[model samples]
Target: MSNISAAIPPVRWGILATGKIAALFAADLALVEDAELAAVGSRSIESARRFADTHSSGARAYGSYAELAADPDVDVVYVATPHGRHVEDVMTCFEAGKAVLCEKALTLNADDGSTLIEEARHRGVFFAEAMWMRCNPNIRKIQDMVAAGSCGTVGQVRAELGFVAKPDIARLWDPELGASSLLDVGIYPLTFTNLILGEPTHIVAAGIKSDRGIDVSGGATLTYTSGAVASIAWTQMAWSDNRAAVSGDGGRIEIAPRFHETTGFSHARNWELDEFAEPVLGRGYAHEIIEVNECLRAGRTESALLPLDGTLEIMRQIDEIRLQIG
Candidate 1:
């Protein structure tokens, strides 16, 4: 940490949207001792004011994202806009010389994601995808254990996430918003598998598309060079168990329901079972906030836990899956 970093006790945050996900992140930001929800921006001043009043009384509200990005008091801006608008929103922040933490599925496609990341690097601005699950303490613990051979020679991984999204939710059904179950819910399971098994050598996928041509439900089987296999699924048409598990020759680790945000898991081996648990801070979003704060304070450009390369890789994988299913 620099002297300036040490001088500032709390890192200031600016939220770029006032949607549900943005609200969830703002609420979680309150839980971090070293973070401050300093500002919020929306296309409408009323919406921004409402969000500020509801989430943080002292936070400033901006009528436009450009104004928020231009605020000198804000050390970093969280881009919570829709996936389709990520490139434009993120570029605005970058141009203003502000660090950014954008929501997952960084962009609608790998090419756009690459462009944004390259621009961030060229500008020497800090950037990260808000893949909060990768920042979850419990999930990190699982990664360490698996790397330590706790799940020896892992052979198979199974994961799924889904919810019944109605038509009223335009973002979930509108192709113009870059809506797709794969980009929304499916990214979780795909990321989970990649974290454990590395990149896949082959992928076979099939999906059911809505009238607007967006995938509403899908499943993919990924095969790795080590002969490990992963079966992952996602849907926006119905509810799913939202569970995940990893099996190997030695044992199996099962994450509880809503696995991406799970606080615990069970490891079974030799007719015995052991459990591991960790505290999830404020709906599991605080961890990522903390990570960004630490990185900013330390003058780091990207997170090692959720690296830009990793995010780009996932986007490429999704692109491939979409191509196959289409």
Candidate 2:
């Protein structure tokens, strides 16, 4: 690592949109040194002030997103808006010449993601898709193990995430808001597949659509050029095993339930089983936060691990999957 890769000095953070994810991010940010919750913006001033007061003391609160974007004190901004508004929100950050860490599925489609990348590059601003899983130490270790041939030729992989979400939730049922479980939850498993199998050569998708013309539950099969296969599934209407497993002729590995978050994993080789789990550090978001801080400190515009190319390819896969299902 270069000397410039040190953690950022006194990084000031501004949050756009005050919601559950925003609150969680603020709480996690507090656990990292040299990082400050400088401001938060919401559609309502009162709401912004409430979030600031509860999550960050003495932090500026703006009633509108544009004001927060224009805050000169903020070194970087985290765009936490709904999926439908990500493009506009991220563009606002870029317009204000602020580095951005936007929430994932970075944009509604692959083309939009490319647009964000183009603008960020044109302006020479730091940008990253908040694919937190890619930044986790445990996930990196797993990737290393797979590359070392621990799983032996890796013939197949499978991942599932699901919960019994009620239909009353607006974002869960509203088609206009990008309410597909495939986009909201399935991205995790799909990303996992991409990490393990690279990009798939062919994809087959089918799912259950809601009355609002949204996919509430879905499953997909991905076949790679190496002849490896991955099966992925997500649902907002039921409970599932929520485990991910990879198998090969030599051995197998199983990530514990709720694999999206860095928990633990089980590995078996030659009928011998072992378990591995990394120590916790601030609900697992701290790692990604640290990665961003290091990138900014090094004056880098994009992360090598979470590059835009991978994000765009995943999006293309998403588009293809949705097309097949529809």
Candidate 2, residues 56-171, lDDT tens digits: the string is 76799999999999999999999988777899999999999999999888988899999999999999999999888898777888898999999999999999999887757766
Candidate 1 lDDT over 235-260, as tens digits, reads 99889999999999989999998999
Provide the lowest-lDDT 10-residue window in model 1: 1-10
The pairs that clash in candidate 2 are none
Global lDDT for candidate 1? 0.94
- TM-score for candidate 1, residues paired by index: 0.97
Instruction: Give the count of colliding residue pairs in each prediction.
Output: 0, 0
- TM per prediction: 0.97, 0.96
